[model samples]
Target: MIRKIIHIDMDAFYASVEQLDFPELKGKPIAVGGGGDRGVVAAASYEARKFGVRSAMSGVLARKNCPELIFVKPRFQRYKEISQQIRTIFYEYTDYVEPLSLDEAFLDVTQNKMGNPSATLIAEEIRNKIWNQTQLTASAGISINKFLAKIASDFNKPNGQKTIKPAEILPFLESLEIKKFFGIGKKTADKMYHLGIFTGSDLKSKSQDFLEKHFGRSGLDYYHIVRGIHNSPVRPNRTIKSIGTERTFEENLSSEIFILEKLEYIVEDLSFRLKKQNVAGKTITLKIKYSDFVQQTRSHTVPYYLSDKELLLDIARNLLFQSKLKESVRLIGVSVSNLNSDQKKKPIAVQLRFDF
Candidate 1:
């Protein structure tokens, strides 16, 4: 049976939230993130998009491109709260909800408990509900599978919805450019262009073996994506392979005190999150980025998984002190991995729904 997959993504999520909270910022080109030399854009409003500003673009370049761009410091704490608010909204439709990030998630509503037969209409209702509850706009894509739905959501973004029925799959795929294909990064897309494979029709002509030989595992994915086939599920309650958070600074700094302040904040957030999820990790990783954009990470694993914030903070501070950077620090991120074994508690599958 054809699956009903819906991908819901917020429009310029961070920037939009900033605008909603600050009325004066509405209808203005805005970027959310630091505006200093070392900062990168975290989110760009629709008005900012007109000036070619985008997420992850250097803040210095963004200013050069859009002289009037407004930058706001990120409030990840608030973003996380809003994320949970939206998760509650998804549960109203179906249990097969898979969150992709803070502002987007996938819902497998093939058999919804709400008695709604049309996934497209369900997406419409969910979008409306999000707007009503959070005063934020969301775009949704409805399709037979996750891959198609994800692409469709991007088609009409910023408070929009797009549907890709199975019948329209071939034409849709044929008309797409090689650059837009999923998993085809900039480097890979350029390689495909050189190989004369620029569209679905071009990709369909190649055999699976030929694709695997050229693209490795991704080649097989590319071959099937063109045919509108992806068996990957909207994984729910996905194991926490890692739990961490990071933020870009407004300016490069060598101030250990200021960095420690930021680290403490993230540690608080991580501890609260892990405790809420009832999971702990044995490995701690410290990520650092320099003004020159060089990034480095250091990790240590312990014998026992622990959720102690004090332990994590102490080790993370030591890692930062040891990381000698040629340039001032531009960003810092923290993460914990090697989660505690699950043999102590009931399996997540059972705890999640209790179906069995």
Candidate 2:
């Protein structure tokens, strides 16, 4: 049976929250993050985006692009509180809500409590409820599956909604640019462009064997997804297997001291996040990406849950030096898995419900 999926994404979530809380900041170009050299933008308001500012862009570059842009420190607690409120609204419709992050979620409403046959109307009502409750806006995409729904949500953004009907699915996909496919990234898109696969139609024309030969395992996914065959469910109650953070440096560092310094910051961030979630893990992973983009990972599993930053740093340092550096490193990451779920204040899954 064809499933009805809706992808709801809050437009500039963090920045929008800030604007809602502070009325004076509404029409201005605002960013949510540290406004320092090493800082990265967590969100950019539409005003800031008009100036080419975006999330994940370095604050230094964002400021260069929009000198008048205002940067507000992120308030994750406030964001989470609002996220929970929004999620409560989702549960009222259907418990098949799968949160991707604090700002976006996938809802399976094929058989909803309201018995609403129209997914588009459900999306509209959800958006209206969110705006009414939070004084914020969200964009929604409605389609037969998660992939199409996700792509459609971005079509008319910032308090708008779009629906990709069953009949239009194939045509909509055929005319789609390859870069817009959910799983396709910028680098992959570039490779596809060079390979004469500029659109979904181009991708559909390529044999599965041809795609696999070029993209390995992911090529198989591309082959099916382009043909409008993504069957991945909107799985609710997804468990968190791990928590981690990584950073790519502006310049490659060969000095071990410099690398260690960066590792300290990464460990600090990881520990704070773990503490915030009241979760800890036994396995520590160290991810390193060299200057040429070659990557390596080293993991050390301990008998006890590890949340201590100092200890984490020591373990990460050993993992780093244990592996001989092949070249200067461009990026580093630290993560922990084998999580202690008992410590969580609440279950990770959306509250389950069934339509009788």
Q: Best candidate, lDDT-wise?
A: 2
Q: List per-prediction Cα lDDT, in the order shown.
A: 0.82, 0.87
Model 2: which residue pairs collide?
237-349
Summarize candidate 1's per-residue lDDT along 1-356 as a digit string, tens digits.
Answer: 67888999999888888999899999999998768875667789999999999876778899999999999977766777787898899999988888777788988888788978788999999999999999999999998878889999998887999999878999999889878876777778878888889887888888999889988988888888999888777777655578887878878878878888777766655664565355789899999988889989998888988776788888888888885656788888989888974544432331121110
| Candidate 1 wrong stretches, greater than 4 Å | 243-298, 301-336, 339-356
Model 2 scores what on Cα lDDT? Answer: 0.87
Q: Residue 34 error for model 2, in Å?
A: 1.2
TM-score of 1: 0.75
What's the lDDT for residue 294 in model 2? 95
lDDT of 2 by residue, 78-120 (tens): 8889999999999989888888778899999988889898889
